[model samples]
Target chain A: MPKKSSSTKNLRSALRIDPEDGVVDLADYSPRKITTGPDSRKASLAALEDLGAELVDLQTRLYADGVAGEQRSVLLVLQGMDTSGKSGVIDHVVGLVGPEGTHIRAFKKPTEEERAHDFLWRIKRELPGPGMIGVFDRSHYEDVLVTVVHDQIDDAERLRRYRTINEFEAGLVAAGTTVIKCFLNISYDEQRERLLARLDDETKNWKFNVDDITERRMWPEYQKAYAEALAATSTEVAPWYAIPSDRKWYRNWAVGVLLRDTLRDLDPRYPKTDLDIPQLKRRLAPPN
Target chain B: MPKKSSSTKNLRSALRIDPEDGVVDLADYSPRKITTGPDSRKASLAALEDLGAELVDLQTRLYADGVAGEQRSVLLVLQGMDTSGKSGVIDHVVGLVGPEGTHIRAFKKPTEEERAHDFLWRIKRELPGPGMIGVFDRSHYEDVLVTVVHDQIDDAERLRRYRTINEFEAGLVAAGTTVIKCFLNISYDEQRERLLARLDDETKNWKFNVDDITERRMWPEYQKAYAEALAATSTEVAPWYAIPSDRKWYRNWAVGVLLRDTLRDLDPRYPKTDLDIPQLKRRLAPPN
Candidate 1:
C-alpha cells in the first residue's frame, strides 16, 4: 500500500535514485514491483482516487501562493519508453488537478526551427509560470537518451549536455522551482504485451506506431542509455525517481505519492490579504 | 429541469443566441434562470456527474481522431464579469476530461510585447492543434468588450474590431474548428456576493483582487458591452450562448452539456489503421 504520509518512513525516498548509492542498475529494479502502492488492483485504484482529492488541495494551495506573488512552482518530468504510460500517467495522475493551474507539455520530435536552436530552447519556452504545476511528457533529457542511443552524439557531447542540464536545473532551483524527474521503468516483455494489446484493439490502432516496434527492437541499447543518463543527470537539486511501470496502477499510485509529498513539503500558504476587509465588505454592501 | 438529451426540445438552442433571431437583449435573460438544467440543485449536480462520464468518452474519441491526423478541433470561449465562475467551470466541468486532450489558456493583461502586435497575434499562437478541445477564459472578444467599455476606442474603431474578430473566427472555422462562445450571465448582486465571499474565506483571499472591485463597479458598463459584442459576433459560423450563471451548479452543467452535444454532433471516429495487422502480430511472435 502507498504508506500513509504520517508514517515514520519517508516514502518519496523509496523511489529516489541517488547515484552516490551505487552504479545505477536498471536490471535490479523490477518493473512490476509494488513498492509504495497497494498490492491489490482494487485497493490501489481506491488509494489513487483518495490521493487525487488530496493532490487537488495541495496543488491549488501552491497555485494560490503564486497568485500572492510566490515564485515557487513544481515541474514533474515524465520520461519513459513507448507504452510505458507517460501520457497515461499524465491523464490518470496529473489530470486529477484542475487545468487552471496545471500546465502540461508533450514534446514531440524537434521541428526544424527547434532543432536549429539549442536542445533546451523549446523546453525553456514551455516552462510553467509561477504557481503552476508543469508536467513534461518528454523533456530535455531526451537529448542525453535518444540521440546517444541512436549514435547521433558521442560520449563527449553527451557529457556536455549533462553539464548543461544540471546547470539549467540549478538555475531553476535557484529561481524557486522544485523539479521532480520520474523515469517510468517498463520491462521489455511487458512492453510487448502492451504493444500487442494496442494492435488487438481497433480503437487503439491509432496509437500503434510502426516506430514503436523499431524502437523496441533497440530496447537493450535504449536501456543502457537510460541507465547511464539517469545516473549522469540525477542531481541533488532534481533527482530522478524510477517508477516501476509494468503494473499501471502501481506506477500511477507511486507518482501521485511523490507529487503529494513534494507539494506538502513546499507547504504553500494562502496569502494573508493586506486589504481592509471590513471596509471592503462595507463598500460591497451598497446595491448597484 | 435539465431535460434529457432524447427529448425533442433541442435544449442547446435555448441557451444559444442566434443573431438572426433578434438583437441579444441581456434584460430578457435572468441570471438565475434554470432553462436547460435540472430545477433542483441536487438533481442538477447529480445530472452533471452523469453527463461527465459520457463526456469523457466523447472527448477521447475526438482526441483519437486527432491522433489519426484529423484536423478538426473545438474551442470553448468563456466570457463574463468578475466572479462569473470562468475558472470554476473549468475546474468543475472541463476538469472531468483528461488534460491530454484538453488545452486551456487563461489570458491575462497583454505585456509590452503583446501590445506591439495585432490583437489576434497572441490568440492565433495559442489555437489548439488537431483533435483538441481549447477553452479560453477570456478571448479575442475582450477587444470588443473590455476596451470598448472603457472607451479606449471610438464607435467606428469598435465596429472595426468586431469585423476583425468575425473574420478571424471565420478563418478558424474554415480551417476546421468549431467555436462555442459562452457569455456567462452572472448578475451584479452575484458578483458582490462572490467577491465578498472570497474576502470572507482565508483560502479564497488570494483570488480577491482589488481590480475585481474596480471592474465590479463597472458591472452595468460591462453588461452593456457584452450584450452588444455578443450580438455582433454571434454569427452563423460561431454563435455565442448566454449561460445563466448565478447558480454555479447550473452554469457548470450547461457548459458540460454544450461540449458533450458539440462533440456528439461532430461524431469524431477512431482512425482506422492501414498497417498490415496480421504481419505485425506475427512478427511479435518471436520474443527477445
Candidate 2:
C-alpha cells in the first residue's frame, strides 16, 4: 500500500478504542449473558430507557441548535459482515435522534449510474446537509471490502482505490464533516446462527439470502480486506470503531453511547431570540 | 390583490377547482374528503402498511438508479399545521413506499446556518437525490403560512414570498426534481376538538403550548395564506393537492391513492440479474 498522509495516520491512531472502553463496551463484551450488576433486568431496562431518553434530549438540542444555525453535521458510516445487524443498529441507535434531524441512506448494489461513476461518487452525493446527521447502512466501504474480498477488482487497483477512499474521507473531514465509522464485529458462529434463525422464520425470509453466507465463505478474504481498509482509511478526521455485535442489546447501547459522546463533543448551542411576550400579549389582548 | 398570471388565469379558468375564478379563495374550496365509505377504514389500514413498504422499495430503487446515472428524483413534501396529522400522513404514505426505497426528511426549524440563508436554502440542501424519494414535513411553505399567520413578516414580504416560492418550485421541476406538495386541511371544529383531546392527555402536554392556540386564532390568515400559496405555486411541474385530514383513516387512504398513483407513474423496474444457484451453492458449501 502507498504511504498515507500525516492526517490519515493520526485518525487511524486515535480510533484504537480499548476492548472494554465504557459501560457500552462492557455491556457488549460478553454476548450470551448480560451483566446487569446490581440493577435487575427491569432496572436495566429502565436505565437503558433513561439513557435513550437522555440521548434523545441531547440529540434534539443538537438538532435544534444546528437548525438555529450551528449546522454541525455528523455522518455515521456502519460497515460490517453479513448478519452483523447494520439495519438493527440503525433502527436502535438513530431511534434517539428524532426523524427531523437524522437522515438515513442505505446503500445497496451499485446502480448503472453508480457503477458508471467512481465508487465513492454515490456515497458522497448522499452526504447530509450541515446540522443534519446522516447514517449509511452500508457505504462506499463496500468498494474496498465486499468488492475486494470477492476479487471483483485486481489487487493493484484495490490498493489504489483504498488510497482514493482514504483521501476522500480526509476531504470530507476537512470540510467540517464528522465521520464516525463503526464496524459491527460479530463472531462467525454467531453470524451463522442469526442467518439460520432468519431462515427458520417465515416472516424473515425476505431478509435471508443464501448468498450472504456464500459471501461469508470468503471470510478470511473479507477480514483481510476490512483490516487493510480500516488501516488505510481510519484517519484522525474519521476513525473506525469496531463494536462487538454478538449481543444486539449491548450493540445498540454502545452505538447510542458513542453517538451521545460525539454529539456532546460538538456542543451545539441553541440560538437566542428576544421575544417580548409580555408586551406582545398587551398589544394582542387588552387587560380586563 | 395583484392580477393572476396568464398561466394561473388559464388553469383556474379551465378548471373549476375553486368557487371563485378570479380571486384565490380558501373558503371556496376545501380539501377533498375521504369518507370512511364502507371498507375505507379497513382498506386504509392495509394500504398504510403497503404504503411504507412501497416507499422503502421506491426510495431504495431511486437511490440505486440515481447512482447508476438516472436523472430521476422524487420529492414528496408533506405540509400541514399542528394536529393536521402530518406524522400520520407520513406513517401512512411512507408505509406504502417500503422502508428500502424511501428517504424521509422531516424539517422542523431552521438551523443557524439555514436561517442565515433564505428559507428555501436549507430546503434546497435537503432535496432528494436522484432515484430516491425525499419526504419533507413542514417544508418551505412554512415561510409563507406560519410566518404570515404568526406575523413573523409583513404583508409585502409575504406576497413577495408567494412568487419566489412559485419560481423556486418551478426551478426544482425544471431541474428534473418531481415535487409533489400535499397540504393537509383540517376544519376548525376538528382542530379545536383535537387540541382539547391533546390537553386531556398528560403525556401530550409537552406538545401543547398555550400560544399554539393563539396561532390557531389566526385561522383565517393561515387559510388565506395557504390558498394564495397553493394558487401561486401550483404548476404543471409541481401541483399542490389538498387532502382532508379530519379522519385518520380517510387521510391515509387518500394519501395512499396519491402515492400509489405517483409511484405507478414512475414505474420502477428491478435490476436485471441472474441468480446462479451453482455459484451460490459452491460458495456456501466449500470444497472438501
Candidate 3:
C-alpha cells in the first residue's frame, strides 16, 4: 500500500473536519487563515501554477486509465455562500485541465421535472464517468443547505437527506470515485465587500442578486445550518474541507493544493496495452 | 426596425449559405478564404479583441434585460468535424464573457436513457435559460449528420429529423432566442495535419481517438451528410454560415464579428429600476 504524501498529510490536518469532533462551530475556522509562511503569497501563486500542470497530467492519466477499463473517477464538490469565489476556483484550478476531460455542472433552481424525482436522481445522472474530473459548482448539498435555511424542509427531512447523502457518497466510493468536498468558508464582512463590488461594477451587475442580500440578512441562521449539515454528513468515505476563502488567491491556491495532493494519493497509472508491440511495429514499417 | 450594420452585411454576404441555392458542394468552398483584407491577420486579431470587449458589454445587457423580464437569449450552435477547432472558437470567442452569464453544453454519445427519449428531448433540457448565452458545442445537428453518415437511421427518418430540427429552431426563435449556427469548414488535408499533430504531441495523445481515424476514412460520406444537413436546415429564422475555419485566428474573428453584430441587432437594454431612489441612496450613503 502506498503512503499519503507529506503535502496531503499537511492539507488533511489543516483543512479536514472529522465528524467525530462533535458539533462544528463556524466561528472557530478563520476565513483568512494562511497555512503557508509569511510573505508567501507569491510562492503560493507559483506553487499553484506548478500543481495545476501536475493536475493536468494526473487527470489525463485518470482519463486514460478509465478508457483502459478502470472504473475510477474524481468528483470535486464545491459548496459555499454567494460571492464565495466558487467560480474563481473553477476557472483557475479546474480549468487548467483540458475541457474534454473536465465535466462541469452548475445546479440551478431545479425545474418542475427535476423536482419530481428524488434529489439524487439528477445528481447521479451527472456524475463523472470513468476517467473524468467532475466539478459540481453547487450540488445536492443544496437539498439540505438552502432548504433548511429557507424552511422549505423540516429538521426531520433535513436529517433524512443527510443520511441519504452519506449512503450515496459511500456508493460512489465503493464504485471507485474519490469524492473531495470543499466548503469555501468566507466571513460575513468579506461577503458584504464582494457583493458591494458586484453592485458597483457595471460589467458584474448581472451577477448581483437581491436574493443574495436577503440571504445575507440571515447570515447567522445560514452559518448554523451549514455547521449542522457539515457535521451530520462529513464522513470517512467522503470528507468535507472547510477552506479559508477570504483571500481569492489563497482560496484558489489551497483548492489546487488539496486536489493535487488528492490525485497524488490516488496515484493513477497509465495502463499497459495488450497488443503485441513488435508485430504492430512490423506492420507499420515502410512498405519498401 | 434597426438596419443591419455594415460589418454584419459584409459577413453575411461572405459566409451565409442559402438553401434555395441548392446542394452545398464542399469542394466549391475554400477553407482558407480570407474575407478581410490581405495582410490583415494582425488587424483581424486586433478587431477580434475589440469585438470581444463589446461582446462582454452586449452579453451583460442581454442578461440584465432577461432579468428585467425580457425573454431574449442567444444560442450559438457549432457543428464541425474532428480537429476543426470547435472548442477553440468556444474558448476564444464565447469565453470572453463571464461564465455566470454563459452556459456551455457539449453533447457526447447518448446514454441508454437519453437514447430512449426522442432525439430532441435531451437537447431541449440543456437549452440556455432566459438571459443566458448558450453554446451547443455539438448539438441536435449530430442526429442528422452522424446518424445519416453511419446509416443509424433510415433516410425517411433522417428527413423527419430535418423537419423536426427546423420546427424546434423555429419555436426557439418565436420564443425570443437569436439562434446563430456555424459550420466550421476545414479541408481534408487540414484535418489530416491536425490529427497527425495530435498524435505527435504526447500531451494531446489522450485526445487522439482511434475512431477519429476510422471516421476520417469515411470523410466523403460525412461531408455529404453535412452538406445535406446544412442545406435542409438553413432557414430564414435560423440561418447557417459555412465558416472557413482552416485559419484559426480568422475563424475566431469571423465568429466574434457575427455574434457582436447579432447582439447589436437585438440591442438589449438595461432594465429601469422601480425603487425609491432617494430613500435607498440615503440608506446606503457613507458615514461622515
- What does DockQ give for each predicted structure? 0.74, 0.11, 0.19
Summed backbone clashes in each candidate are: 3, 47, 0
In candidate 1, position B260 carries an lDDT of 86
Per-residue lDDT for A1-288 in model 3, tens only?
011224535875578876555577776677887654223678768877878669878988888888778999999999999999888988778866656567778888898989999999989988988988889999999999888989999988998999999999999999999999999999887987787776666556666666676788788888999999999888988989888899888888878878888888889877665544344334333357
TM-score of each: 0.95, 0.60, 0.85
lDDT of 2 by residue, B52-137 (tens): 55655555555555644667888888887778988776655664454434568677667787889888887887777777677888
Which segments of model 1 are wrong by more than 4 Å?
Answer: A1-8, A20-22, B1-9, B20-22
lDDT, candidate 1, at B82: 79
User: On residues A1-288, what C-alpha lDDT tens digit does candidate 1 reach at each position?
Assistant: 122233314667777777755367887667886555578778878988988878888888888888888999999999999999999999889988778879998898899999999999999988989889999999998898889889999999998998899999999989999999999989888998998999999889988989888888898999999988888888889988888899998898889888888998999877777988998898899755
| Cα lDDT tens digits for candidate 2, A1-288 | 211223422322323433221112322223333332212445434545666666656665665555455656788889888888888776656745545556788888898988998888888778987777889999988988888877789889888987888788888878767888888878777876776665555434445565687687777777778777776665667767766567777666656666777777787655443434344334344336
- Restricted to chain B, the TM-score per model reads 0.94, 0.80, 0.93
Question: What does the lDDT read for residue A259 in candidate 1?
Answer: 89
lDDT of 3 by residue, B56-159 (tens): 78887898888778999999999999989988987778766655567777888888989999999999988888878888999999999888888899989998
Best by TM-score: 1
Model 1: docking quality category: medium
**Of candidates 2 and 1, the better by TM-score:** 1
Which structure among the candidates has the greatest DockQ?
1
